[model samples]
Target: MITQTISLYNWTNGVIMIAIFGLVCLTLIGILINFMMSGKKKDKTEN
Candidate 1:
C-alpha cells in the first residue's frame, strides 16, 4: 500500500509526496496526543 502510494506520487516528482506524507504524519501525531490527553482528563475527573 505504501509503495503504491509512493509510485503514484512519482508523477509529481516526489515533492507532493513528501508534503502529503509530512501532513499525514503530523495529523496522526496530533490525533494520538489528543487521545492521550483526553484519556488523562477523564481519569482525573473520575477520581
Candidate 2:
C-alpha cells in the first residue's frame, strides 16, 4: 500500500512538471510574436 501511494505521488509530480513546462513554452511563443509585430510596426513608421 505504501509503494502504491508513492507511485501515485510520483505520477502526479510528473504531470505537474509537464504542465508547467507547457505553460512556459506557450508564454515564450507569445512574447516572441508580440516582439516581432512591434518591431515591424516600428520599422514601417521610421521609413
Candidate 3:
C-alpha cells in the first residue's frame, strides 16, 4: 500500500512537470512568432 501511494505521487508529479514544460515551450514559440511578424512589418515599412 505504501509503495502504491508513492508511485501515485510520482506519477502526478511527472504529469505536472510535463504540463509546465509544454506551456513554457508554447509561450516561447508564440514570442518567436510575434517577433518575426513584427520584424517583417518593419522591413516592409522601411522598404
- TM-score leader: 3
Candidate 3 error regions (>4 Å): 1-9, 43-47
Better of 1 and 2 by TM-score: 2
Clashes of each: 0, 0, 0
Give all TM-scores, in the order shown. Answer: 0.61, 0.68, 0.70
lDDT of 1 by residue, 1-47 (tens): 89987776575767877899999999999999999988865455767
Better of 1 and 3 by TM-score: 3
Q: Against the hidden true structure, what lDDT does model 1 obtain? A: 0.84
- The local distance difference test score of model 2 is 0.89
lDDT of predicted model 3: 0.88
Tens digit per residue, CA lDDT, model 2, 1-47 = 89988887687789999999999999999999999988875455766
Give Cα distance to truth, residue 47, candidate 3, Å.
5.6
For candidate 3, which ten residues in a row score worst on lDDT? 38-47
lDDT of every model, 2 decimals: 0.84, 0.89, 0.88
Deviation of model 3 at 12, angstroms: 0.2
